[model samples]
Target: MSLTPLNEDLGVLRFITAGSVDDGKSTLIGRLLYDSKSVLTDQLSALSRAKHKRTAGEDIDFSLLTDGLEAEREQGITIDVAYRYFATARRKFIIADTPGHEQYTRNMVTGASTAHAAIILVDATRVTEVDGQTELLAQTKRHSAIVKLLGLQHVIVAINKMDLIDFSEARFNAIRAAYLELAQRLGLQDVRFVPVSALKGDNIVFASEKMPWYQDEPLLDVLESLPVAEQDGELRFPVQLVARQDGSQADDFRGYMGRVESGAIRVGQSLRVLPSNRSATVAEIVGPSGLLDQAFAGQCVTVRLAEDVDVSRGDTFVSTESALQPSRKLGADVCWFDEEPLSPQRKYLLKQATSTVYVRVGSVDTVLDVTTLSHGTDKTTLAMNDIGAVQLSLQKPLAADTYDSHPATGSFVLIDEATHHTVAAGMIRTLAA
Candidate 1:
C-alpha cells in the first residue's frame, strides 16, 4: 500500500478486467481484495450497509465495490474505469475494472491501453448469446480488437459463472473453443482459458470442486507465472522535461527527465538527442539511487549527458546508430470515442508520450464494419466507438514507434481541440510509411 520507492525492487503489473455484467467481474475482484486481506474494516462496513439497501434475497452484490459513480450505482452497472490497487509479496497489481456493456466499449480500449495483461470474463452456457439486434457480436469484435491493439498478447480468458450453468464440462469447453477461435484470428500470444465461478470463488485463487471434470493450473498460478518482456530490447526514452539541478565547474549537472518507456540505458553510453541531431555520452543516472551513471527501463530516472544538449520535454533519446526517425505525418488505427463523427476538416491535439501536437485527418482510408471486423474501403469519417485506419498530418513532429514494437511511444490519445477532453485513442502503425 505504500508508494513504490526507487530502490524497492518492486515490479508493478497493470491488469484490466472485461466481461458481461453479473458475470462476476466485480465480485471476483472484491473477493481477491477481501480474501487477500487488503480491504480495511471501514470499507467492509460500507459494503455491509450497501448490501442492506439492496432488495431482499439478492446476493451480496460485490459490484458495489467498484461502481463508485452515482449513476452507475443507480443503474447497477459499471459505466467507467474504476481502478483498484492490491499487492502480494511477489508483485504489486493495479486492476482496471471496466464496463462490460457495449455502449461503454470505449472504456475497455482506454483501460487496456495501459495494461500489461487483460482478463476477459466469459459466461459458460450451453448456448452463446449473440444478440442479433444489438450489443452482442459487434461488442465482441470491438473488444477483441481493442485488446490486440493495446499490445496485450498475454490474455487470460476467465470463463466465469459455472454455477449458473451447472458447472458442466461441455459448457466450459464450448465457450473456451469459441473464445480461442477469436484469439487465434487476432494473432494473440499465450492465450489461455480458465473456467471458474467468480461469484463462488471457484478456480480463481484455487481450483473449483464443483467441476471435477475440469483440470488446469489454477487461475492465480497462471497470472503469477506469465512472462514479462525483457528490460531492454530497443531503447526508447521520450523526454518528459529537462532540469538544471545544479551548475558549477566541479559538477555541471543538466538532466533530461522522463519515464523510460522501453529498454535499459547505461552511463558512459553514447546517445542521439533528437530534434537537434546532437549526440553525447550519458554522464549520470539520477534516481532513488541518487545520481548514478546508468539505469534500466521501466524506471523513472533523470539522465545527464556529457554535453549541454538543447533537449526538452517531447524529445527522445536513443542509440546514435539506431535512433528512430521522427516525423509529423503518421498512419494510425483510431478508436473514436466521441459522439460527433470525426471530420477531416477539423484538427485535434494528438498526445503521444510527452509530445502534444495538433493533427488533421489527411485521410480516413478505411474503417472496419466492426460487426464483421472486415475493412470498409473509401471511408471518410467515423462515428462513436468506430474503429478505422487514418492518415494524419501533425503541426509538429513526434518520435514514435509501432504499437507492436514499443507501446509507450506508439500509442496516443486524441484531445478535442476546443474541449481538451480526450475523444479517441490511437495506435501509430509507422512513421508516415
Candidate 2:
C-alpha cells in the first residue's frame, strides 16, 4: 500500500462519529463496516452467539458490537476513542468512534480535533417527544458547533432509527431541515442529512429500499464523494534537519532534510528560507529511491543547495512569494487535554514546526461556552477538554504560520515543564507581518 505522507499526498481521511446516548452511532458504524463486508467471520460469529444469547433471554442488543470496553459495555455507551480502519476503491477511512454523553465531551473533542469530517447521529423521536432526551438534540447541536469552531466544514447529519418511525420521509426531512438551519447559523457548510435504521442496516452502505420515497445518495456514497481536507491549501514544508552527504572524497556536501508538509517540491528551483529571508538554488533533491528532480506533498526529501549558507533545522523553505517571518508572540486556540488548567503566568515548551521555545502564557482571551457556542468573558482558566483562545510570549522569535493558512506550521503543542507531557494542542492565530 502506498502511504500518503502529509506533504503532497492524497492520504487517508480521518473522521469521527458523535451522538447523544442511544442515538445509535456505534450501531451505525458497525452496520457500515459489516454491510461493506469489512468485518471478519469470526467476529460475526461472536456477534451471532451474543445475538443468540440476547434473543433467547436477551435484549437483542447491538450496542455490544462496538462498545468494546468493560466500562463502556457495562454502561452501554462509548467513552473513549475506538478507532477502526477500512477502505474502498476511492479512499481509505479511519473512524474515531466517540462517546456522546456530555461527560465525555472532552473525548468527543479529542476524536474530532484531527477529523476531516464528522457524523452527528440523532434519533428522530427524541426531537418531537417530550422526554428527558430533549437535551439530546440540543447536545448534538452543541457538539457540531464545536466541530465547526475547530474548522471542520463538512458535517454529515444522520437521523437514525427510521424503522421505529415506519420510515416516514416527512419525519426524516423535518430533522434534516432543522439540522441544516442550525448548521447555517453555526457557519458550517456541506451539511448532508439522511435517515436510516442502523439496527436494520438501512441506507448505510447500500440504499435502503424501505425508504423508497426518499431519493438521496446513501451514507457510503456521500463519504466517497466528500472532498479531502488536504487538497484545500497551498504547499508547506518545515525543515526538520540539515545533513552533509559527503562525496567520500570532498567531504563538503550539505543538504536540508525534512518531511514536506504540503505542496510539490522540485529540484534546481530557487527557494527562499524563512525567518532569515535568505535564498538558495536547489541543486538536487534526494529521496529514498536516490535523487529525483521533484517531490510532491508528503515526500521526505533532502535538498542540496548550490551555494552553502547557514541553514539549520527549524528553518522553513518556501516558494519566494510564500515566505513568512517568525514571530516572538502569537495567539492560539488551545484544546486543553490535561488535568491541569493553563496558568496565566506559567511557562510552557511550545513546539511548532522544528523550533521549541519557552513561552509564557500572556493571557487567555476567552473560554468558549460549549452549550451556547458563545464566549464566556469572565472565564480565565482553561480546564481539561476546554477550548479557549490564548496569547503567548516567546523567548525567541520563531517561524510560524496561522493555523488557517498552513496547518503543519501553524499548529503547536504545549509540553509540561515538569513532566514533559503534552498538555495542550494549539492552533497558531497570527504571525509577524
Candidate 3:
C-alpha cells in the first residue's frame, strides 16, 4: 500500500501529542503513521528490528517509530520533540511528539507553542493511584495548563490502553469527567475525549469493533475535522533584512524583506516603523515571481517604500492605525528552563523577533502550582521548569503587544549573556501597567 496525497485545497493541521512518561504518546503516533500507510518500506524494516529490542509479543511495537534517540530507546522514554509529517485524502498534518517527564516540561511547551491543537494521552490503567485513589497526574495537568496558556483552542484527551481494561466505559467516563472539570477551569475550548488502544489499533484510524460501545469517530477522524485558528489583525511586519540586490548605488532599488505577521499589505498602504516612528507608503511589493498586488499574514515578501527611510533589521513596520506601543518595561509570563534559578541580580539578553536587547528580571509576581492551579507569592527567584509571572526592564524600548491581542509581537526569549543559551520563554501581558 502507498500513502496518498491530500487535496491542495485542504490546508494543514498542526497538532502536538503530550502526556506523562510511558503514557503511550510514542505508540499513538506510531499507530497513526503505520495504519495510515505513511511508513516507508525501509522504515518498516527498521521497526521490525527494533521491535525485538523492546517487545516480545507478536504485534508490532509502534513506539519504535518515534523513540529515535538511543538513550530514549534504552530508557524507554521520550527526551525531545519528534516531528512527523503525513497526509490523507482529506487533510495534511504535522504532529509534534513532546516528552512527558516533568524535567522536560520546557520541551513540551516549545513543541505545543506553535501547534493548532494538542492531543493529551492518558493510560487508562494508570489513571488511578496505587491506593485505588482517582487523581490527575501532575505532569498531565502541567501540560494541559501550558497548552491553554499557549492559546491552543483545540484539545483531545485520548484515553489509551483501553484494551487492557476490557474497554470499560465506566473507567473512561470517570477519567473524562475529571478531565472535563480541569479543562473548564483552564478555559480550554473544543475539548474532546476518546477511548483507544494504540497497540490494538482500536478507535485510532477507524472504528473499533472490540468495544461496540463508542459511537464517535476515531482519533484520525476528529483530527481531520478540527478547525485551525484564524489570523485576524492589522499588518505587523518586523524587518529582518534590508537588501540592495543590484548595487549600493543611491539610485539602485532597496527592499525591506520580512514575513507579514498579520493582516494584508499592498502597494500604496501606509505603514509606520516602530521605535523609530517613521512613516512610509508601500511603493512596490516584490516577490520571487516579480511584482505582487498584496501580501497577507504568513507570506514572505519584500517591500519597497515611497521614500528611502533609515529602516534596518529589528525595526517593525505596522499599520499606521494599529501600531503597537513601544515600552521599556513589560509584565509577562515566563517559563524558566535554566537550572541556574532566575534572580533579579542577573541580567540576560531579550530576543524578540529580529530585535535583541539586554533585560533583567524586575520582579516575579507569582508562581503557578500545576496540580492545584494555585498561585504562590514569589518575588525573588524561579527554579527550572517553573511558570511564573514576572516584570522585565529592557535596556531599550521594545515594540510589543499583549499575547491575547497579537502573538507574533507578544512573545520573547531570554538568553544567558555568558553562555548565549536561551533561559526563558515569555509571553507579554501588559506594558508597564
Candidate 4:
C-alpha cells in the first residue's frame, strides 16, 4: 500500500500518543526522540544520574525522558499530558504524551484536540489469542473510538513490545487483524500498522532486522510521510478583543483583534459578523510586524472594517460567501469530564472559540459503548469520562460549522456555572432547524 504525500507547507506536525497503561506510549516517544538525536547532552546526563531508573545495569530508562511529574515518576505512569518538541531534517514535530489510564481520558482529549494525527501504542503482549482470533484491551478500543470521534486525519498503530513476544510474525498478524476490524467498525480510514519494540528501539527510527517480514517503513518515516489535515478555506476570525485608540493624535481607530482560526483574510474582502449578521468590508489588515496585505490561518492580526459595526470579543468574522450559519440549537457529541452526572436541568456555560454563552442540555440522544463501538439510546445520565450525543439549547446563536468540516469553530466546552469548571467537551454534528 502507498502512503499519502506529506504537505511541506504544514511546517510542523502535531500528534498525540495514547494507549493502555504500560503500553509503552512514553517509551515509544522517548525512543523516537533519542534515536533521532533530539535529546540534549544535559538531558542524557540527567537520565544516567536519575534515581527512578526502571532499566537495570545503567541501561537508560527511556520513559524518564517524558513522564516528568514527580508522582508520575514514582508511579511509573503518565498522569498529565507532557508535550515535547523535536525535529528531523525533513520535518518538525510536536508530540503530546497523554496518559493511558481510563480516568485521565480528559487529558487525552485535551491533547488530541489540536493534533493532526495520533500514534496509538498497542502492547503485543496485552492481546489474547484464541482460535486465530485476538482480543484487544478495553483501553485500546476506547482510545481508537475516541480517535475516530475526534476526526483525526491519520492514525498509526504501533504494536509495541515486539521483543517481549519474540518478534513472532503470526502474533503480529493476529493483532493486526483484530485492530483492523476495530478500525473498520469505528470508521477510521487512514490507518497503518507497524511492529515495534520501544524498549529496544526496533522499527521506531530504523527498520528492525528481526522483523524482516514487515516490509513497511519505520514509525518515524510513516509519521513524516503522513499528510497533515488541511484547514478549510473559509475565514473564521473570532474577535478576542476590540482594539481602540481614542486619544491618539491620528484619527480615532477601532480594530477587531484576534487570530485567524482558519482560512485567509485580505484587504477589501467582505465579512459578516456573527450573531448580529452585520456586513462590512475589510479596510485594513495589520499584523505584529505592521500592515499586511493578507493574513492566513494561524495568524494574529487586527482588522479594521470599512464601516464601523457593533463588534465585540465574542463576535466572529466569517466570509460572506461561506455556508456557515448562526444557530441557537446544536446537536453535538460530548465527552463528559466532571464527576457529577450530566444534568439537563442545570444551566451550563458553553464556550466556543472566543464566545461564552449560557447553554442547557436539551436531551441526551445516544451514549457510546466503546467496547462494542455502538451507540445506545436507552441511557439518560452520563458520568465521568462518558461519551454521549446530546442536543444543546443556547441562549444566543453561534456562527458554527460541523466539526468534521471546520474543527476550530465547531468544537466547544461545557462549563459548570456554579463551580466555573469545564464539565465536557463537545463537537458540533448538526445545526438548528
Judged by TM-score, which candidate is best? Answer: 4
Q: TM-score for each prediction? A: 0.88, 0.87, 0.95, 0.96
Q: Model 3 misses residue 314 by how many Å?
A: 0.8
- Model 1 TM-score on a 0 to 1 scale: 0.88
Backbone clashes in candidate 1 total 1
Question: Sorted by TM-score, highest first, which candidate order results?
Answer: 4, 3, 1, 2
Pick by TM-score: 1 or 4, better one? 4
Model 2 clash count equals 6
User: Which residue runs does candidate 1 get wrong by more than 4 Å?
Assistant: 1-10, 51-59, 125-137, 245-253
Cα displacement (angstroms), candidate 4, residue 367, comes to 1.1
lDDT of 2 at 42: 80
Question: What residue pairs clash in candidate 4, if any at all?
Answer: none
Candidate 4 residue-wise lDDT at 343: 97
- Name model 2 segments beyond 4 Å from true: 1-12, 49-66, 128-138, 232-235, 245-249
- Comparing 1 with 4 on lDDT, the higher-scoring candidate is 4
Q: Please give, for residues 292-410, the per-residue lDDT of candidate 2 as tens digits.
A: 98988778999888877788888878876664776888988888878888888998999987878899988988887766667787888888878889989998888787876777788
Error of 1 at 178 (Å): 1.3
Give the Å shift of residue 9 in candidate 4: 6.4
Q: What value does the lDDT take at residue 208 in candidate 3?
A: 94
Please report how far candidate 2 places residue 377 from its true position, in Å: 1.1
